[model samples]
Target: MLRTILRREHKNRWERRAALVPESIAQLAAQKIPVAVEPCSIRAFPDEAYKAQGAELHNDLENFQLVLGIKEPPVASIAPQQVHLCFSHTIKGQPYNMGLLQKFIDQRATLIDYEPIVDERGVRTIAFGRFAGIAGAIDSFFVLGQKWLKMGKPTAYARIKQTKDYPSLSEIKSELAQLRVTNDKPLHVLIVGTGNVGKGAKEVCQWLGLPEVAIDEVLAQKAPKSSWFSVASARHLHERIGGGAFDYQEYLQLGKAQYRSIFDRLLGQFELLIQTPYWTDKYPAHLDIARMNENMQALPLVVGDISCDVNGSLKCTKKISTIDEPAYSYFVENDGIQDGIHADGISVMAIDNLPCELPVDASRHFSAILTRYVPELVKMDLNQTLTHSGLGKELQRAVIVYNGTVMPEFTYLQHYLDRHKLTKPSEAS
Candidate 1:
């Protein structure tokens, strides 16, 4: 029933990056999907403006299908506004759409929760269930990340070391008290990987009440952590006076000696290294990333950069652990080449839900991705299955609505209430 779709303009810096994708790659995306480009905007909404000729939003719904670029929550309630999503609504603040509205509820789903240390199912069962309300959004690839994706930029894992400069016991105690986490020692941590993910990791460390260091700050200084050392970018080495590939030995002998002295001249303070994994089609960054790891055969490291190699693959099983890794990615990935850490290396950690960080700002445009496509989505999803009958009685007993509203069961209603609370009353109202 749908034929043409419009790609929204990239307004945000991140979106701008996503939009400027090279022609070859854009063609590759179009290989199977017959997608056409048009600037999508919510202004297309029927009542949006000076309607001297007040008209229906769609002049021809039959021919053109509006495809929401992003998936938004269902708003079964009235007067939709600001990421509006709902099940049922009240006229006098009382149920207007009942049982019919409840039908849309996706309830009684088992939620997969995990704790590092556990028994029963053992720690292996890190994820295997569902829940009442799980926040879902378009986080697979950030707009800026899309830019980097198209650029095929290099990624690295950054690790910051904690040295004497690290907070003392008193300071650690002071900060821990604020976060409600208690520790005997100052609790040194290493964060690796660079770019956005690394920045996010530093923020998380700060959240966990730990000291951190980034590579940029370290690189600027003469005395980096005495313990671990980072080499140089492989890409940088290529721009020599003559311009020919240098052999490993000659490369080492000729390049900055800082890398060589790293091991032998340990800065006297490092326990870990966080390195990114992404390497561009360009060889320099890749070789640099690999060489750094090859030399430091001792210190522990946490590689946060999930994407590396051609295609920016997320596969990590090749190195270790096959739990397949969770989508924790990055909550707010930023290029944190500064602050947050004490160690000396750029970090690379994956950050998820970048758009949601400021959805209102993003909503300004993401809504375009959604509003334009929603009707088709609605029509397309008309026959698509959504209910989870597998839950059985737990569903019946737990679910309050199925093609209706008012699921009193906590397994259902509680979640709806919680999500509604996330938005301002006027918006969610």
Candidate 2:
């Protein structure tokens, strides 16, 4: 696969939103791989989670090379996907923190290196899913099909066994009803940040019994003036001393000289929110957070800063399910051994060794790209000789709940039988 490289003004901004990433870089350059577009903006690195797509690949770095970008392709400040392959990128290379910028809120996790593919694939395949931190660079290649394949196949890889358990709540309600969100209603969420993604979206909404709502300063100080709303990270819109007159535990230590208008007045009560990558750039104080909520027909939940504002927004054309980073699979890093065949002969590589790369081929390429976005096992018709796609140990079909709901939305809060205001004491008065 010779060259590859591309970005060409992010391929004319996803070809004016018709997106195919320039027909999949002209079918990966017909197949030989020589591709090379580069006007630039394929992001994910050091700290560039869309700094206007790294200032537009820093004024178009020379137009082309051997690139095939989605994340890592920018270089000049020092980026060869960050030298000799840091080989982590399962989805995360930027966003240690953002705008209201909590300065990496404590940042960690970046210690990859197994040693130049440990001599010829001793182990390595990291096909990412869940927390690869901040992912986004997938191409899931194919001139073929993807409308949830049934038509001769473009996606159906398998290997999910070490004992399986993924997408079952009717495969995450048929992948959240293939993300239609035009009007299922229930998506008002607002979480913000502090850690463990606001306790995992309050434990995936008390494990999906759903309903937690919290953006009150008495409803953002009775927002009216013909509400379409605009807190813009509260740079200065003081409605007679603004919402709940400061004291949410003393403004959580007055960080960012006051939570950039308290997370823009708690995301102006919700056009569908959920932040925390420390809230990037801290904004005019809102630099396009959750589609800046003036109500583009509602329905948003830009969680954990992963979908990078719905795939680097110019303004939501739709179709966004980003987690980031994609290269199929490759790694063996941590440059240690190599001069011991005597020095070059013994060669097994890696001193830090994050499990000799390839933990079951990076857990079966993150369980076949997270079971192709978990359509809750589309009612499994398996047994036709079973391939499901690749690396295998299990998944002939297993996932315990995304619909019947269980496995891990925070274990449905130990079956809470609703207590607290169990009344009585007030009746005595």
Candidate 3:
């Protein structure tokens, strides 16, 4: 029988999600595939749930050649030549996880990262992005309300609950339904990106009865004051430096086009900005710090850096905040950071793990997509090259490392590995 194992997530205590739900285990078992699950005390699903679904409870993983997890595994626990699947978070050669990447390479393990499982068009096939957007938007509003309260300007959002405080998205929308534009000035909201994250934010805005507006209308001061939101795509946020029109294809090529942000002009009009676009060094910063310093009053009162690429896309996002301590004040003048949004700076919410706040719903959504590929995973022959193997093409594309070597698609990470001295672990005496 094809044997597989599901390991417990020890990397993050707050991460209670599982890559495969117990129902998925039952489906795999019905196909004659044997599955085992490590005991987890804190996972959203209890250990008995897996047992009820025909999964064997066993800590012994030596017999299982394939292991699945939601997050990265501990370096010491990985067995050589095992097929490990999880969110390695190493595609970027992230400094913090270089050691973990090195351990995978040294152990001759095969790693299939979840984040890179994209379609031919590069859209992620599976992710927690939707929930992240939902939680992020909710948290952004909470921060905005708290900041207003601190300024002695109470708003309708003061009665709204934090993202984690809500039992479900339905309850969240229910509370938002109660929110009315009671303030003299209608709160203007700007949402960047039209992907899943942006859609989530837009849903909340619409639930609150906020009408959508155009950039030109907002700039012309014709935008509605009490309850309105404006959505901007890549073209609206950036343009060529020399008054040239923004070309999507040209922008994809990093050095071919010189682009600068036009976000500053739109900043002053909106009370809040929810940024959800994927950002890299190639793109211009959404909110240029130097430009913001020149016109502090023009900036939005609150910025929800939902993408949360610290110091990558959003210049003001210098730190990765936690769910417990989600917001901070980013001072543009001296580039200083404070605990809350005081009079000295603008409020920023850049929580890295937004989906954790809505784990139950997120896990169900994630597992549904994941279960579809299990048949291919259980029957795949590891003897053949991954490219030639029966592993689904989607899974094949996501394999960053195989048998102690980086794949051609991920060769770019080699420079990072070399820079970080990712040498093989020394043989113990």
Error of 3 at 421 (Å): 1.2
Residue 355 in candidate 2, Cα distance off native in Å? 22
- Report the C-alpha lDDT of model 3 over 1-429, residue by residue, as the tens digit: 347899888866778888888888888778777678999998888999999998888887666778888888888777787778899989878866777787878988788899989888988989998888888988998898888888888878777677888888788888788776544347889999999999888888887777888876875668865678988888876778787777888887852248877677676788888999887777787676778887788888888999898886677888888887889999888887888666447899999888888877888888889877777777767677887768777888999888777889999987888767744343221
- Candidate 1 regions with alpha-carbon error over 4 angstroms: 1-66, 70-195, 212-278, 285-296, 308-324, 327-429
Those runs of model 3 whose alpha carbons end farther than 4 Å from true positions after fitting are 181-185, 219-221, 255-257, 341-344, 422-429
Question: Model 1 Cα displacement at 310 (Å)?
Answer: 6.9
Error of model 3, residue 399, in angstroms: 0.6
lDDT winner, 1 or 2: 1
**C-alpha-based local distance difference test score of model 2:** 0.26
The model with the greater TM-score, 1 or 2, is 1
Worst 10 residues of 2 by lDDT: 135-144
* TM-score winner, 2 or 3: 3
Global lDDT scores for all candidate models: 0.28, 0.26, 0.82
Per-residue lDDT over 1-429 for candidate 2, one digit per residue giving the tens place of the 0 to 100 score: 112233332322211111113333333334434333334333211113222222222333333212222222222222221111122222222231011011111121111121112213332332222222111100110100121132332222111110012223233323323433222333334444434334533443333333443334325555432212121212222221344464444444453454433333443344323333332232223323343345333333222232333322212211222112111111112212222111111111111111111123323333343223222222222222223422132232211111122224223322321121232245336
